[model samples]
Target: MVAITDKEFKQLTEYIKVNYGIHLKEEKLMLLTGRLQKVLQQEGFNNFTDYYHHILNDQTGQAVVTLVDKITTNHTFFMREADHFYFFRDRVLPFLANTVQDKDLRIWCAASSTGEEPYTLAMVIDEFFGKDKVFWDTKLLATDISSQVLDIAKKGIYSNEKIAPLPKHWKTNYFKKHDNENSVLIDKIRNEVIYRKFNLMDTTLPFKKKFYTIFCRNVMIYFDYKTKIELVNRLYHHMEYGGYLFIGHSESLTKEFTKFKYIMPAIYRKE
Candidate 1:
Protein backbone atom coordinates (compact mmCIF):
# COMPACT_ATOMS: atom_id res chain seq x y z
CA MET A 1 0.00 0.00 0.00
CA VAL A 2 1.36 3.45 -0.91
CA ALA A 3 1.31 5.87 1.98
CA ILE A 4 0.52 9.56 1.45
CA THR A 5 2.42 12.01 3.61
CA ASP A 6 1.22 15.56 4.40
CA LYS A 7 3.36 17.23 1.74
CA GLU A 8 2.15 15.17 -1.24
CA PHE A 9 -1.36 15.23 0.20
CA LYS A 10 -1.53 19.04 0.29
CA GLN A 11 -0.22 19.24 -3.25
CA LEU A 12 -2.87 16.89 -4.67
CA THR A 13 -5.70 18.33 -2.60
CA GLU A 14 -4.99 21.84 -3.91
CA TYR A 15 -4.69 20.45 -7.42
CA ILE A 16 -8.04 18.68 -7.23
CA LYS A 17 -9.96 21.58 -5.67
CA VAL A 18 -8.40 24.12 -8.03
CA ASN A 19 -9.15 22.05 -11.09
CA TYR A 20 -12.38 20.34 -10.03
CA GLY A 21 -14.57 21.67 -7.20
CA ILE A 22 -13.94 18.50 -5.19
CA HIS A 23 -12.15 19.15 -1.92
CA LEU A 24 -10.33 16.21 -0.44
CA LYS A 25 -10.53 15.69 3.29
CA GLU A 26 -7.54 14.81 5.41
CA GLU A 27 -8.91 11.32 5.89
CA LYS A 28 -9.25 10.87 2.16
CA LEU A 29 -5.52 10.80 1.46
CA MET A 30 -5.70 7.03 1.27
CA LEU A 31 -8.43 7.29 -1.33
CA LEU A 32 -6.41 9.84 -3.32
CA THR A 33 -3.29 7.77 -3.06
CA GLY A 34 -5.04 4.63 -4.23
CA ARG A 35 -7.22 6.03 -7.02
CA LEU A 36 -4.54 8.35 -8.45
CA GLN A 37 -1.58 5.98 -8.29
CA LYS A 38 -2.77 4.13 -11.36
CA VAL A 39 -3.27 7.40 -13.25
CA LEU A 40 0.25 8.52 -12.40
CA GLN A 41 1.76 5.16 -13.28
CA GLN A 42 -0.20 5.03 -16.51
CA GLU A 43 1.26 8.40 -17.48
CA GLY A 44 4.77 7.30 -16.55
CA PHE A 45 4.90 9.59 -13.52
CA ASN A 46 6.31 8.23 -10.29
CA ASN A 47 4.00 9.98 -7.81
CA PHE A 48 1.48 12.71 -7.10
CA THR A 49 4.17 15.36 -6.66
CA ASP A 50 5.54 14.64 -10.12
CA TYR A 51 2.06 14.68 -11.57
CA TYR A 52 1.32 18.00 -9.84
CA HIS A 53 4.54 19.49 -11.16
CA HIS A 54 3.65 18.36 -14.65
CA ILE A 55 0.21 19.93 -14.45
CA LEU A 56 1.55 23.16 -12.98
CA ASN A 57 4.05 23.51 -15.81
CA ASP A 58 1.65 22.64 -18.61
CA GLN A 59 0.30 26.07 -19.65
CA THR A 60 -2.02 24.58 -22.24
CA GLY A 61 -3.85 22.68 -19.40
CA GLN A 62 -4.48 19.47 -21.35
CA ALA A 63 -2.74 17.68 -18.50
CA VAL A 64 -5.14 19.14 -15.96
CA VAL A 65 -8.05 18.14 -18.17
CA THR A 66 -6.87 14.55 -18.26
CA LEU A 67 -6.30 14.51 -14.50
CA VAL A 68 -9.76 15.91 -13.82
CA ASP A 69 -11.21 13.29 -16.15
CA LYS A 70 -9.31 10.51 -14.44
CA ILE A 71 -10.33 11.68 -10.97
CA THR A 72 -13.96 12.64 -11.53
CA THR A 73 -16.53 10.10 -10.38
CA ASN A 74 -18.45 9.87 -13.63
CA HIS A 75 -20.05 6.49 -12.85
CA THR A 76 -23.77 6.93 -13.38
CA PHE A 77 -26.68 5.55 -15.37
CA PHE A 78 -30.04 6.49 -16.79
CA MET A 79 -33.09 6.56 -14.53
CA ARG A 80 -31.07 6.47 -11.35
CA GLU A 81 -33.23 7.16 -8.26
CA ALA A 82 -36.57 6.35 -9.82
CA ASP A 83 -38.18 7.99 -6.83
CA HIS A 84 -36.76 11.38 -7.83
CA PHE A 85 -38.28 11.01 -11.27
CA TYR A 86 -41.46 9.99 -9.52
CA PHE A 87 -41.26 13.19 -7.51
CA PHE A 88 -40.57 15.14 -10.68
CA ARG A 89 -43.54 13.66 -12.49
CA ASP A 90 -46.02 13.62 -9.64
CA ARG A 91 -44.99 16.79 -7.81
CA VAL A 92 -42.61 18.99 -9.81
CA LEU A 93 -43.73 18.77 -13.43
CA PRO A 94 -47.40 19.44 -12.87
CA PHE A 95 -46.50 22.75 -11.26
CA LEU A 96 -44.18 23.76 -14.09
CA ALA A 97 -46.52 22.53 -16.78
CA ASN A 98 -49.54 24.42 -15.53
CA THR A 99 -48.26 27.52 -13.76
CA VAL A 100 -45.32 28.53 -15.91
CA GLN A 101 -46.24 30.74 -18.87
CA ASP A 102 -45.74 28.98 -22.16
CA LYS A 103 -45.16 25.23 -22.16
CA ASP A 104 -41.42 25.82 -21.94
CA LEU A 105 -39.68 24.06 -19.07
CA ARG A 106 -36.01 24.52 -18.29
CA ILE A 107 -34.13 22.07 -16.12
CA TRP A 108 -30.44 22.33 -15.30
CA CYS A 109 -28.71 19.11 -14.42
CA ALA A 110 -25.66 20.42 -12.60
CA ALA A 111 -22.94 17.83 -12.29
CA SER A 112 -24.73 15.79 -14.93
CA SER A 113 -22.14 12.99 -14.84
CA THR A 114 -22.02 11.19 -18.14
CA GLY A 115 -25.51 12.53 -19.13
CA GLU A 116 -27.64 9.92 -17.37
CA GLU A 117 -29.50 12.27 -15.06
CA PRO A 118 -30.34 14.92 -17.65
CA TYR A 119 -31.32 12.31 -20.22
CA THR A 120 -33.59 10.78 -17.63
CA LEU A 121 -35.14 14.20 -17.06
CA ALA A 122 -35.65 14.58 -20.80
CA MET A 123 -37.38 11.19 -20.97
CA VAL A 124 -39.75 12.17 -18.19
CA ILE A 125 -40.48 15.45 -19.95
CA ASP A 126 -41.20 13.51 -23.12
CA GLU A 127 -43.61 11.29 -21.26
CA PHE A 128 -45.41 14.24 -19.68
CA PHE A 129 -45.89 16.22 -22.90
CA GLY A 130 -46.69 13.08 -24.89
CA LYS A 131 -44.81 12.14 -28.03
CA ASP A 132 -46.70 14.43 -30.40
CA LYS A 133 -47.07 17.63 -28.32
CA VAL A 134 -43.32 18.00 -27.85
CA PHE A 135 -42.57 21.61 -27.11
CA TRP A 136 -39.36 22.96 -28.64
CA ASP A 137 -38.03 25.04 -25.72
CA THR A 138 -38.11 22.28 -23.15
CA LYS A 139 -34.37 22.26 -22.65
CA LEU A 140 -31.86 20.93 -20.15
CA LEU A 141 -28.43 22.34 -19.39
CA ALA A 142 -26.27 19.35 -18.55
CA THR A 143 -23.05 20.58 -17.03
CA ASP A 144 -20.12 18.85 -15.34
CA ILE A 145 -16.67 19.82 -14.14
CA SER A 146 -15.00 17.35 -16.45
CA SER A 147 -14.95 18.26 -20.15
CA GLN A 148 -14.14 14.67 -21.02
CA VAL A 149 -17.40 13.40 -19.53
CA LEU A 150 -19.34 16.20 -21.20
CA ASP A 151 -17.84 15.22 -24.52
CA ILE A 152 -19.00 11.64 -24.06
CA ALA A 153 -22.39 12.88 -22.89
CA LYS A 154 -22.91 15.04 -25.95
CA LYS A 155 -22.70 11.90 -28.14
CA GLY A 156 -25.76 10.54 -26.31
CA ILE A 157 -24.93 6.85 -26.43
CA TYR A 158 -25.02 4.35 -23.58
CA SER A 159 -24.64 0.66 -22.99
CA ASN A 160 -27.78 -1.37 -22.24
CA GLU A 161 -26.59 -1.87 -18.69
CA LYS A 162 -26.36 1.90 -18.21
CA ILE A 163 -30.04 2.20 -19.04
CA ALA A 164 -31.21 -1.08 -17.50
CA PRO A 165 -33.73 0.41 -15.10
CA LEU A 166 -35.68 2.28 -17.80
CA PRO A 167 -39.19 0.96 -18.19
CA LYS A 168 -39.99 -1.21 -21.18
CA HIS A 169 -41.98 1.53 -22.87
CA TRP A 170 -39.25 4.12 -22.30
CA LYS A 171 -36.60 1.68 -23.45
CA THR A 172 -38.46 1.07 -26.67
CA ASN A 173 -39.76 4.60 -27.15
CA TYR A 174 -36.77 6.76 -26.25
CA PHE A 175 -33.81 4.76 -27.45
CA LYS A 176 -32.81 2.76 -30.47
CA LYS A 177 -30.28 -0.05 -30.75
CA HIS A 178 -26.98 1.48 -31.85
CA ASP A 179 -25.67 -2.00 -32.32
CA ASN A 180 -25.88 -5.35 -30.58
CA GLU A 181 -24.76 -3.89 -27.24
CA ASN A 182 -25.56 -0.18 -26.93
CA SER A 183 -28.46 2.21 -27.41
CA VAL A 184 -28.49 5.79 -28.64
CA LEU A 185 -30.81 8.38 -27.22
CA ILE A 186 -33.43 9.08 -29.86
CA ASP A 187 -32.61 12.23 -31.79
CA LYS A 188 -35.52 14.30 -30.51
CA ILE A 189 -34.80 13.81 -26.81
CA ARG A 190 -31.03 13.96 -27.25
CA ASN A 191 -31.27 17.30 -28.99
CA GLU A 192 -33.17 18.84 -26.05
CA VAL A 193 -30.18 18.56 -23.74
CA ILE A 194 -27.10 20.77 -24.16
CA TYR A 195 -23.92 19.45 -22.59
CA ARG A 196 -21.12 21.77 -21.41
CA LYS A 197 -18.24 21.93 -18.97
CA PHE A 198 -18.55 24.04 -15.79
CA ASN A 199 -16.59 24.63 -12.64
CA LEU A 200 -18.55 24.98 -9.39
CA MET A 201 -15.99 27.31 -7.85
CA ASP A 202 -16.42 30.02 -10.49
CA THR A 203 -18.20 32.97 -8.91
CA THR A 204 -20.08 33.65 -12.09
CA LEU A 205 -21.90 31.03 -14.12
CA PRO A 206 -22.39 30.94 -17.86
CA PHE A 207 -26.19 30.99 -17.69
CA LYS A 208 -27.81 34.29 -18.60
CA LYS A 209 -31.15 33.11 -17.26
CA LYS A 210 -32.16 31.06 -14.27
CA PHE A 211 -33.65 27.57 -14.44
CA TYR A 212 -36.92 26.20 -13.09
CA THR A 213 -35.19 23.14 -11.68
CA ILE A 214 -31.59 22.25 -10.86
CA PHE A 215 -30.18 18.85 -9.96
CA CYS A 216 -26.72 19.05 -8.37
CA ARG A 217 -27.05 15.68 -6.72
CA ASN A 218 -24.31 13.47 -5.35
CA VAL A 219 -21.49 15.84 -6.18
CA MET A 220 -21.07 17.78 -2.94
CA ILE A 221 -20.05 14.95 -0.61
CA TYR A 222 -16.40 15.49 -1.46
CA PHE A 223 -16.33 19.24 -0.79
CA ASP A 224 -15.22 20.86 2.42
CA TYR A 225 -17.59 22.90 4.60
CA LYS A 226 -16.55 26.29 3.23
CA THR A 227 -16.64 25.16 -0.37
CA LYS A 228 -19.97 23.45 0.25
CA ILE A 229 -21.40 26.62 1.74
CA GLU A 230 -20.20 28.78 -1.13
CA LEU A 231 -21.52 26.32 -3.73
CA VAL A 232 -24.89 26.00 -2.03
CA ASN A 233 -25.29 29.77 -1.88
CA ARG A 234 -24.26 30.18 -5.50
CA LEU A 235 -26.73 27.51 -6.57
CA TYR A 236 -29.38 29.23 -4.52
CA HIS A 237 -28.75 32.49 -6.36
CA HIS A 238 -28.92 30.74 -9.73
CA MET A 239 -32.45 29.42 -9.17
CA GLU A 240 -35.60 31.28 -10.09
CA TYR A 241 -38.15 31.94 -7.44
CA GLY A 242 -39.76 28.62 -6.44
CA GLY A 243 -37.12 26.69 -8.31
CA TYR A 244 -36.45 23.22 -6.93
CA LEU A 245 -33.08 21.78 -5.96
CA PHE A 246 -32.52 18.05 -5.87
CA ILE A 247 -29.39 16.76 -4.25
CA GLY A 248 -28.10 13.30 -3.41
CA HIS A 249 -29.95 11.27 -0.80
CA SER A 250 -26.77 11.38 1.27
CA GLU A 251 -26.35 15.18 1.02
CA SER A 252 -27.96 18.08 2.83
CA LEU A 253 -27.67 21.88 2.74
CA THR A 254 -28.77 22.17 6.36
CA LYS A 255 -25.29 22.81 7.65
CA GLU A 256 -24.72 26.13 5.88
CA PHE A 257 -27.74 27.19 3.91
CA THR A 258 -30.78 28.39 5.78
CA LYS A 259 -32.66 29.95 2.85
CA PHE A 260 -33.97 26.65 1.53
CA LYS A 261 -36.72 24.84 3.38
CA TYR A 262 -36.16 21.13 3.25
CA ILE A 263 -39.02 19.69 1.21
CA MET A 264 -38.37 16.00 1.72
CA PRO A 265 -34.80 14.90 1.80
CA ALA A 266 -32.30 15.53 -0.91
CA ILE A 267 -34.83 18.10 -2.14
CA TYR A 268 -35.15 21.80 -1.31
CA ARG A 269 -37.01 24.85 -2.57
CA LYS A 270 -35.95 28.49 -2.47
CA GLU A 271 -38.03 30.17 0.16
Candidate 2:
Protein backbone atom coordinates (compact mmCIF):
# COMPACT_ATOMS: atom_id res chain seq x y z
CA MET A 1 0.00 0.00 0.00
CA VAL A 2 1.22 3.48 -0.84
CA ALA A 3 1.33 5.81 2.15
CA ILE A 4 0.50 9.53 2.02
CA THR A 5 2.71 11.72 4.20
CA ASP A 6 1.42 14.77 6.08
CA LYS A 7 2.89 17.27 3.64
CA GLU A 8 1.72 15.28 0.61
CA PHE A 9 -1.77 14.96 2.04
CA LYS A 10 -2.00 18.67 2.79
CA GLN A 11 -0.72 19.57 -0.65
CA LEU A 12 -3.14 17.29 -2.47
CA THR A 13 -6.14 18.28 -0.34
CA GLU A 14 -5.47 21.99 -0.78
CA TYR A 15 -5.18 21.61 -4.54
CA ILE A 16 -8.55 19.85 -4.74
CA LYS A 17 -10.21 22.33 -2.40
CA VAL A 18 -8.96 25.33 -4.36
CA ASN A 19 -9.63 23.95 -7.83
CA TYR A 20 -12.87 21.99 -7.23
CA GLY A 21 -14.25 23.23 -3.89
CA ILE A 22 -14.11 19.73 -2.38
CA HIS A 23 -12.92 20.13 1.17
CA LEU A 24 -10.83 17.31 2.62
CA LYS A 25 -9.80 17.59 6.23
CA GLU A 26 -6.77 16.08 7.94
CA GLU A 27 -8.80 13.17 9.32
CA LYS A 28 -9.56 12.03 5.78
CA LEU A 29 -5.97 10.91 5.21
CA MET A 30 -6.85 7.25 5.51
CA LEU A 31 -9.88 7.67 3.26
CA LEU A 32 -7.82 9.43 0.61
CA THR A 33 -5.06 6.83 0.84
CA GLY A 34 -7.54 4.00 0.51
CA ARG A 35 -9.34 5.56 -2.48
CA LEU A 36 -6.15 6.22 -4.39
CA GLN A 37 -4.33 2.99 -3.59
CA LYS A 38 -5.31 1.24 -6.80
CA VAL A 39 -4.45 4.26 -8.92
CA LEU A 40 -1.05 4.65 -7.24
CA GLN A 41 -0.20 0.98 -7.71
CA GLN A 42 -1.32 0.97 -11.32
CA GLU A 43 0.62 4.12 -12.16
CA GLY A 44 3.81 2.86 -10.45
CA PHE A 45 3.87 5.64 -7.88
CA ASN A 46 5.27 4.41 -4.57
CA ASN A 47 4.31 7.54 -2.64
CA PHE A 48 1.56 10.17 -2.65
CA THR A 49 4.03 12.95 -3.46
CA ASP A 50 5.03 11.24 -6.72
CA TYR A 51 1.40 10.71 -7.61
CA TYR A 52 0.67 14.36 -6.87
CA HIS A 53 3.51 15.44 -9.10
CA HIS A 54 2.20 13.30 -11.93
CA ILE A 55 -1.24 14.90 -11.61
CA LEU A 56 0.23 18.43 -11.72
CA ASN A 57 2.45 17.61 -14.68
CA ASP A 58 -0.10 15.89 -16.86
CA GLN A 59 -1.20 18.29 -19.62
CA THR A 60 -3.96 16.20 -21.21
CA GLY A 61 -6.15 16.94 -18.11
CA GLN A 62 -7.27 13.30 -17.75
CA ALA A 63 -5.13 12.80 -14.67
CA VAL A 64 -7.20 15.35 -12.78
CA VAL A 65 -10.40 13.77 -14.11
CA THR A 66 -9.41 10.37 -12.76
CA LEU A 67 -8.36 11.90 -9.46
CA VAL A 68 -11.68 13.72 -9.04
CA ASP A 69 -13.69 10.63 -10.00
CA LYS A 70 -11.87 8.43 -7.51
CA ILE A 71 -12.01 10.94 -4.66
CA THR A 72 -15.56 12.33 -4.96
CA THR A 73 -18.60 10.33 -3.90
CA ASN A 74 -21.50 10.02 -6.34
CA HIS A 75 -24.06 8.11 -4.33
CA THR A 76 -27.48 9.11 -5.71
CA PHE A 77 -30.59 7.18 -6.68
CA PHE A 78 -33.93 7.81 -8.35
CA MET A 79 -36.31 9.87 -6.22
CA ARG A 80 -33.49 10.47 -3.75
CA GLU A 81 -35.38 13.47 -2.37
CA ALA A 82 -39.04 13.06 -3.25
CA ASP A 83 -40.39 16.28 -1.73
CA HIS A 84 -38.30 18.52 -3.99
CA PHE A 85 -39.64 16.72 -7.04
CA TYR A 86 -43.20 17.03 -5.82
CA PHE A 87 -42.76 20.76 -5.15
CA PHE A 88 -41.13 21.16 -8.56
CA ARG A 89 -44.08 19.53 -10.26
CA ASP A 90 -46.79 21.15 -8.12
CA ARG A 91 -45.55 24.73 -7.78
CA VAL A 92 -42.38 25.60 -9.68
CA LEU A 93 -43.41 24.20 -13.03
CA PRO A 94 -46.75 25.92 -13.10
CA PHE A 95 -45.15 29.26 -12.22
CA LEU A 96 -42.47 28.91 -14.88
CA ALA A 97 -44.88 27.67 -17.52
CA ASN A 98 -47.13 30.66 -16.98
CA THR A 99 -44.59 33.41 -16.45
CA VAL A 100 -41.74 32.72 -18.87
CA GLN A 101 -42.91 34.66 -21.94
CA ASP A 102 -40.29 32.99 -24.16
CA LYS A 103 -41.62 29.53 -23.22
CA ASP A 104 -38.06 28.39 -22.46
CA LEU A 105 -38.18 26.58 -19.16
CA ARG A 106 -34.46 26.54 -18.35
CA ILE A 107 -33.48 24.17 -15.58
CA TRP A 108 -29.95 23.19 -14.56
CA CYS A 109 -28.97 20.19 -12.44
CA ALA A 110 -25.56 21.44 -11.40
CA ALA A 111 -24.31 18.43 -9.47
CA SER A 112 -25.97 15.75 -11.55
CA SER A 113 -24.24 12.61 -10.32
CA THR A 114 -25.11 9.64 -12.52
CA GLY A 115 -28.19 11.53 -13.86
CA GLU A 116 -31.07 10.53 -11.53
CA GLU A 117 -32.05 14.04 -10.35
CA PRO A 118 -32.09 15.69 -13.76
CA TYR A 119 -33.86 12.70 -15.28
CA THR A 120 -36.50 12.93 -12.58
CA LEU A 121 -36.92 16.63 -13.34
CA ALA A 122 -37.33 15.85 -17.03
CA MET A 123 -39.93 13.16 -16.31
CA VAL A 124 -41.90 15.57 -14.13
CA ILE A 125 -41.84 18.22 -16.83
CA ASP A 126 -43.02 15.69 -19.39
CA GLU A 127 -45.94 14.72 -17.15
CA PHE A 128 -46.87 18.33 -16.35
CA PHE A 129 -46.96 19.53 -19.93
CA GLY A 130 -48.30 16.32 -21.47
CA LYS A 131 -49.62 17.08 -24.99
CA ASP A 132 -48.45 20.67 -25.11
CA LYS A 133 -44.82 19.71 -24.43
CA VAL A 134 -43.94 20.27 -28.09
CA PHE A 135 -44.80 23.96 -27.92
CA TRP A 136 -42.39 24.67 -25.04
CA ASP A 137 -38.66 24.06 -24.70
CA THR A 138 -37.71 22.20 -21.50
CA LYS A 139 -34.28 20.82 -22.24
CA LEU A 140 -32.19 20.57 -19.05
CA LEU A 141 -28.46 21.02 -18.55
CA ALA A 142 -26.95 18.45 -16.17
CA THR A 143 -23.33 18.82 -15.10
CA ASP A 144 -20.75 17.31 -12.77
CA ILE A 145 -16.99 17.46 -12.34
CA SER A 146 -16.56 13.72 -12.74
CA SER A 147 -16.47 12.67 -16.38
CA GLN A 148 -16.94 9.03 -15.39
CA VAL A 149 -20.37 9.68 -13.81
CA LEU A 150 -21.27 11.97 -16.69
CA ASP A 151 -20.56 9.09 -19.08
CA ILE A 152 -22.82 6.80 -17.07
CA ALA A 153 -25.48 9.55 -17.04
CA LYS A 154 -25.27 9.98 -20.79
CA LYS A 155 -25.93 6.26 -21.25
CA GLY A 156 -29.10 6.51 -19.09
CA ILE A 157 -28.86 2.88 -17.98
CA TYR A 158 -29.34 1.72 -14.40
CA SER A 159 -29.85 -1.48 -12.50
CA ASN A 160 -33.40 -2.39 -11.52
CA GLU A 161 -32.54 -1.82 -7.87
CA LYS A 162 -31.12 1.62 -8.64
CA ILE A 163 -34.39 2.69 -10.27
CA ALA A 164 -36.76 0.94 -7.85
CA PRO A 165 -37.73 4.13 -6.01
CA LEU A 166 -39.43 5.78 -8.99
CA PRO A 167 -43.19 5.73 -9.47
CA LYS A 168 -44.73 2.74 -11.21
CA HIS A 169 -46.15 4.92 -13.96
CA TRP A 170 -42.76 6.51 -14.47
CA LYS A 171 -41.10 3.10 -14.71
CA THR A 172 -43.71 2.09 -17.23
CA ASN A 173 -43.68 5.18 -19.42
CA TYR A 174 -40.11 6.47 -19.26
CA PHE A 175 -37.91 3.40 -19.25
CA LYS A 176 -37.42 0.28 -21.37
CA LYS A 177 -35.80 -2.97 -20.33
CA HIS A 178 -32.13 -3.07 -21.23
CA ASP A 179 -31.77 -6.64 -20.02
CA ASN A 180 -32.88 -8.81 -17.13
CA GLU A 181 -30.99 -6.78 -14.53
CA ASN A 182 -30.93 -3.25 -15.99
CA SER A 183 -33.24 -0.74 -17.63
CA VAL A 184 -32.55 2.19 -19.90
CA LEU A 185 -34.33 5.55 -19.86
CA ILE A 186 -36.37 6.14 -23.01
CA ASP A 187 -34.75 8.60 -25.41
CA LYS A 188 -37.57 11.08 -24.97
CA ILE A 189 -36.56 11.58 -21.35
CA ARG A 190 -32.88 10.89 -21.94
CA ASN A 191 -32.43 13.47 -24.66
CA GLU A 192 -34.20 16.08 -22.63
CA VAL A 193 -31.17 16.18 -20.28
CA ILE A 194 -27.84 17.27 -21.74
CA TYR A 195 -24.83 16.14 -19.73
CA ARG A 196 -21.60 18.16 -19.42
CA LYS A 197 -18.50 18.22 -17.23
CA PHE A 198 -18.44 21.34 -15.04
CA ASN A 199 -16.43 22.49 -12.07
CA LEU A 200 -18.47 24.61 -9.68
CA MET A 201 -15.30 26.48 -8.68
CA ASP A 202 -15.00 28.08 -12.10
CA THR A 203 -14.97 31.85 -11.65
CA THR A 204 -17.44 32.53 -14.42
CA LEU A 205 -20.44 30.34 -15.16
CA PRO A 206 -20.37 29.35 -18.83
CA PHE A 207 -23.98 30.01 -19.75
CA LYS A 208 -25.21 32.58 -22.23
CA LYS A 209 -28.62 32.77 -20.52
CA LYS A 210 -29.64 32.34 -16.90
CA PHE A 211 -31.70 29.43 -15.56
CA TYR A 212 -35.24 29.41 -14.16
CA THR A 213 -34.48 26.60 -11.73
CA ILE A 214 -31.23 25.02 -10.52
CA PHE A 215 -30.84 21.77 -8.54
CA CYS A 216 -27.42 21.86 -6.90
CA ARG A 217 -28.34 19.33 -4.26
CA ASN A 218 -26.22 17.23 -1.89
CA VAL A 219 -22.81 18.02 -3.31
CA MET A 220 -22.30 21.27 -1.38
CA ILE A 221 -22.01 19.39 1.90
CA TYR A 222 -18.44 18.52 0.95
CA PHE A 223 -17.30 22.14 0.90
CA ASP A 224 -16.32 24.36 3.82
CA TYR A 225 -18.24 27.49 4.90
CA LYS A 226 -16.30 29.92 2.76
CA THR A 227 -16.24 27.67 -0.28
CA LYS A 228 -19.94 26.95 0.08
CA ILE A 229 -20.83 30.65 0.32
CA GLU A 230 -18.69 31.52 -2.69
CA LEU A 231 -20.36 28.79 -4.74
CA VAL A 232 -23.85 29.83 -3.61
CA ASN A 233 -23.07 33.42 -4.60
CA ARG A 234 -21.88 32.25 -8.02
CA LEU A 235 -25.02 30.17 -8.54
CA TYR A 236 -27.13 33.13 -7.43
CA HIS A 237 -25.63 35.28 -10.15
CA HIS A 238 -26.59 32.84 -12.90
CA MET A 239 -30.23 32.28 -11.97
CA GLU A 240 -33.20 34.19 -13.28
CA TYR A 241 -35.01 36.48 -10.85
CA GLY A 242 -37.74 34.56 -8.98
CA GLY A 243 -36.08 31.26 -9.94
CA TYR A 244 -35.93 28.46 -7.40
CA LEU A 245 -32.90 26.58 -6.08
CA PHE A 246 -33.35 23.14 -4.55
CA ILE A 247 -30.61 21.87 -2.29
CA GLY A 248 -30.32 18.75 -0.17
CA HIS A 249 -32.60 18.73 2.85
CA SER A 250 -29.53 18.23 5.01
CA GLU A 251 -27.99 21.44 3.63
CA SER A 252 -28.97 25.03 4.34
CA LEU A 253 -27.79 28.47 3.29
CA THR A 254 -27.84 30.92 6.18
CA LYS A 255 -28.85 34.52 5.41
CA GLU A 256 -25.25 35.71 5.85
CA PHE A 257 -24.12 33.27 3.18
CA THR A 258 -26.65 33.97 0.45
CA LYS A 259 -29.15 36.37 -1.07
CA PHE A 260 -31.65 33.62 -1.96
CA LYS A 261 -34.87 33.82 0.05
CA TYR A 262 -35.68 30.73 2.00
CA ILE A 263 -38.98 29.25 0.90
CA MET A 264 -38.85 25.91 2.71
CA PRO A 265 -36.41 23.65 4.54
CA ALA A 266 -34.36 22.94 1.45
CA ILE A 267 -35.80 25.28 -1.17
CA TYR A 268 -34.72 28.87 -1.86
CA ARG A 269 -35.71 31.43 -4.42
CA LYS A 270 -33.75 34.24 -6.10
CA GLU A 271 -35.83 37.33 -5.69
Best by TM-score: 2
User: How far does residue 243 in candidate 2 sit from its true spot (Å)?
Assistant: 0.3
Clashes of 2: 0
Clashes of 1: 0
Worst 10 residues of 2 by lDDT: 1-10
lDDT of 1 by residue, 125-244 (tens): 888878544553788888887888888889889999878888989889989999999999999889989888888888888788877899989888978877888888888888888889
lDDT of predicted model 2 = 0.94
| Candidate 1 accuracy as lDDT | 0.82
Candidate 1 Cα outliers beyond 4 Å, as residue runs:
1-5, 131-136
Show model 2 residue runs off by greater than 4 Å.
none
- For 88-177, candidate 2 gives per-residue lDDT tens digits of 999999999889999999899999999999999999999999999999998999999999999999999999998899889999999999
